[model samples]
Target: MAFPRSTCLLLLLASFLLTPLEGHTFNVMDYGAIGNGRTDDSEAFMKAWSDVCKASASPTFLVPGDRRFLINPVVFEGRCRSKKIKFKVDGTITAPSEPSKWKCINKQCHSWISFKHVDGLVISGSGTIDGNAEKWWKQGRVTGARPNALVVARSNNVQLHDLSFKDNPHMHVVFHHCDGVKISHISIDAPEDSPNTDGIHLKETASVIIEHCTIGTGDDCISLVDGSTHIDMRHIKCGPGHGISIGSLGKFGLSETVEYIHVKDAQFTGTTNGVRIKTWQGGRGHARNMIFEKIRSSDSEYPIIIDQFYCDHTECHDKPNAVEIRNISYIDVKGTSKKETAVKIACSDTVPCRDIFIQNINLIYDQSGKQASAYCKNVINGYYHGVVRPNISCLQNDKLP
Candidate 1:
């Protein structure tokens, strides 16, 4: 068969164009990352991340299995050339033991592993991130600041799954100022006495989903702070910590808003508090449209609590202003409370909690001799249905002037 030279050249070009481009896989070891658990692998990780960030094709930065790589504080930054990136970690990544060795370049540098300003990022693995944080915990009380184990900040469409975190000095995993984030199949563990080790903390984030996670730590299993909205959490197992809280908001006289949050299908055991919303006294803003449903608790203190005057100090100064909490509902929550008061709604006098609804609550004191109770103050438009302990009549028949 004879063909013109021009026709043949065109055909060749077409074939080349139709071929699929090969994607790059940047291995950490190839970039001089030693997984011996002793050597610092921070530079190697950064080098591999830099390479992948600039790759034209969607690339993967891989940490191989069965090795422990000691990493210092590092940031994986974005505005990357690649539209999608996979951060695969099948091995362990550990922090340094000495707290003084941690470099304090900025507030973001306090995290051991941080992903910032990245879009379409996927962090998935069956591995662990161990913050050797006993020493840091002891030092943090004096220093008044401690590092987080993992943080995803200013990223969109990020997914984190199948990872384990342990012994964080402060918050274990944080999603800060991110949108469209999904976290699932994760496990977080720390000692019950480990100070301020929240399992997962979300702040200034929106459209987030957290599901199928098991978390036990010193602080809240999941904490949604101010500027967080449209969050959904389900199928979570929380214990030995403060169970799933919203706020401590409106702190330092700041105006904070949290809304459209939903939590369901959670179990709490031996927790200090379950499903709580707390706000400082002298602050403004509002928390609204929140729902907690199908929560089961065992020997938990304050299974449901809304403390508008949330002060930890013993000699706290009295303040008039408060965060307006409204349109909150708790449904199908059955539990055994260690404390005599199973439900406490202590709203502020100036800005009362309103439209609070409770249905099908069956909380009882752990001690069979003691009766379950509910305390309410400065709460309005509250509704109750089916088996409310201590009775809603107390609120309905109040004659206070």
Candidate 2:
């Protein structure tokens, strides 16, 4: 049974080549993370993420279940060795309950947890992300000072689903300056009186898809601001919030453009507004080629509206310039309105809305036993198709520049 030394070496090499390497799991607990809710596990999380990013094969950064990890503000850096990196949060990740424990630079921390430059990232699990923002909300200051829960910026091909985000100080999840994003089966919630708690906010992002989400918050369930295009949303349930909005854009006299947006099969209940598009004066650019279809609203105020004169402040100086809105269509919108004006299209007098189409709309004011009506101002070249209730009498087909 004597074999040559070269033959034995060759056999060993073949065995090594055929064997598969198992994927790594970098658990935060293994990196000195205290699973207790009070301990600061920020450094342990960063350490775990560092190893996960440096791993050559598919690796998972796991926050296992049955424990609460208190982590402060941290950013997970990207450009990882493996593109298919998984951030599996099976346990709860909580923010510092008090402002004193929060780490801020110059008294400002914009986001609690941020993911930057991470491409092909997948964040999924049945765990909760608790902002622990009760003290912050009690301050009752309405400024851009509060920190959002989770933010993913400058990334591509990101997927987030099966997560629960609750009681965030401000917006729950924000995707900024990203492309090819998918969010589904996620739950976001906060108290109705919580200020600026938007469910999902997108800015400077494109090629996004949001579906099968249940969101109830103080602000818009989903808001798409400047430079967002090619967005598709469907099967969403929004309530106790400002209904899905597309704007507050062109603020600060900035030029912004949003186009090719589609929202379908959304259900809104007890929301402030159903489908809204608002813009500020003294700004340039246009919002065009948008479609809102198959929306059902119940006891909502302003089921369909387009306010180019959207001024949130008390003293907003009126300017001559305005954001142009064109080629917007609303189809099959059936709703029960809480207010008398079910559909309000208050466009700018200078730059009127063009090619605005409303079709198959049936909205009624069943709350106060009054009639629901339509209000339109500075709107031109509008078209009304099949069964538009409350009859938009102000629509003028005359082309005026």
Best by lDDT: 2
lDDT of 2 by residue, 122-210 (tens): 99998999998888898867544889999999999999999999999989999999999999999998999999999999999999999
Residue-wise C-alpha lDDT for candidate 1, range 1-401, written one tens digit per residue: 89999999999999878654437789999999999999999999999998888876678999999999998889898988877888999999998888877655574346778899999999999889999899987765787678888999999999999999999889999999999999999999999989999999999999999999999999999999989999999999999999999998988899999999999999999999989999998889999999999999889998999998788778767798889999999889987999998888888888988988887788889858466888888778877776566565424422323
Runs in model 1 lying further than 4 Å from the true structure: 1-22, 106-109, 367-370, 393-401
Give per-residue lDDT, candidate 1, residue 75: 84
Residue 135: error of model 2 in Å? 0.8
Q: What's the true lDDT of residue 46 in model 2?
A: 96
lDDT, candidate 2, residue 123? Answer: 96
Name model 2 segments beyond 4 Å from true.
Answer: 1-22, 105-107, 142-144, 368-370, 396-401
Cα distance off (Å), candidate 2, residue 146: 0.9
Best by TM-score: 2
